[model samples]
Target: MRRAMTDQLSGRLVEGGHRLDVRVYFEDTDFSGVVYHARYLHFLERGRTDFLRLHGIGHRALMDGAFGEPMAFAVRRMEIEFLRPARIDDVLQVETRTALLGGARVVLDQRILRDGEVLVEAAVKVAVISPDGRPRRMPPAVAERLGAPAS
Candidate 1:
């Protein structure tokens, strides 16, 4: 059973390009002892952080860099589907992949899974913005890292 479980997850991880492991805590649970719906968004955020890190773009560095432009990313929209319940103490893996990229926005496909079962899936759209809060074209370096063509 354990071997089958590992194989299933491994296959999914490969399909997603990368995987981030996160263990749900008490704070993430609700009155029913299952992970609160909002907490799934937090899990997805963590996954995005790890995904950027893997591509060598840390949030801190982006916020404080030679660009000195004080860049920030805003979630313009998100479509989420909760298929299963996750409980406290459950170790979930978040898979993130870039599905689409536009001049000023990116579409990310993220999923939370446990033991081969998908618990949640989300389509997150984020826009790159300047410190003044105006949407801007993604920096070439960041775009290239994300597999987006450099402008």
Candidate 2:
């Protein structure tokens, strides 16, 4: 399919968020052949990472002080719900959206779906921190870029 032929590595930015296509691998499952519970976190992380990447935010650049003083994004909290199991070889779509973004914190809503069925969902809270691990207010420009209302 033409759609499948594009950007096989990472997903693109959608109207209000990001959608990434991920294929379940053998390693993602346990002996029962269902995806391991912990594995869902990895999938969620990838979606969030790629969401920022597509939005022009890079980890390396952040550490290099691209936005101002060197800083990094760190997960402060996460609440996940595993609704269904996904077997190996299943194609999953990880959707990520910014629920709230301001000052030094961001709350992201992420969902993992298989054929439009939600398999897992999460509410992730991330904090902006300095290299020394102290919380810091995100730079204004960076916040503006990420906090912009989705079209």
Candidate 3:
């Protein structure tokens, strides 16, 4: 029987960050046959989500009040740099690292690279908020987990 693949199969923890492989499909490309600019955001977001998941935090669990309250991370700001274009069928690696952890926010450094060449880079700030949309301090457990590298 084939072994059941787990979340770790989708991505793996690296020395200083998390790495997820993303393939550029036709849907992700523009009329010019290159990856759409905004699609990089989706790739980066997936890396961030998986990074958190590998650290024992999940979107569903957080939304279900697993951390003592229903909360979610909302992107507060993002600065993106488009360095080069990626063609369809190209395999890209999305890297995510927690650059800073604060009471109510976490800053992430993310990059999309192809064959070790950076195609896109971004700095993202995400704020933890309650279900009602009010900013809230990150739970100690969540904060601690995010601050440490995944084992």
lDDT of each residue in 26-139, candidate 1, tens digit only: 999998789999999999998887687667677788778534466877899999999999998999989988888887889888889998799999999999888788998888
Question: Per-residue lDDT for 112-150 in model 3, tens only?
Answer: 999999999999999999989999999999998888433
Candidate 2: regions farther than 4 A off? 1-8, 148-151
Off by over 4 Å in 3: 1-4, 148-151
The CA lDDT at 147 in model 2 is: 68
Local distance difference test, per candidate? 0.81, 0.89, 0.90
Question: TM-scores for all candidates?
Answer: 0.83, 0.92, 0.93
Best by TM-score: 3
Candidate 1 deviant stretches above 4 angstroms: 1-16, 66-69, 148-151
Candidate closer to the true structure by lDDT (higher is better), 1 or 2: 2
Q: Ten-residue segment with the worst summed lDDT in candidate 2?
A: 1-10
CA displacement after TM-score superposition, residue 62 of candidate 3 (Å): 0.4
Candidate 2, residues 1-151, lDDT tens digits: the string is 6545544566988888999999999999999889999999999999998888777788899999999899999999999998999999999999998888878888899999999999998999999999999999989877776764543
- Candidate 1 residue 117 Cα shift, in angstroms, is 0.8
Worst 10 residues of 3 by lDDT: 1-10
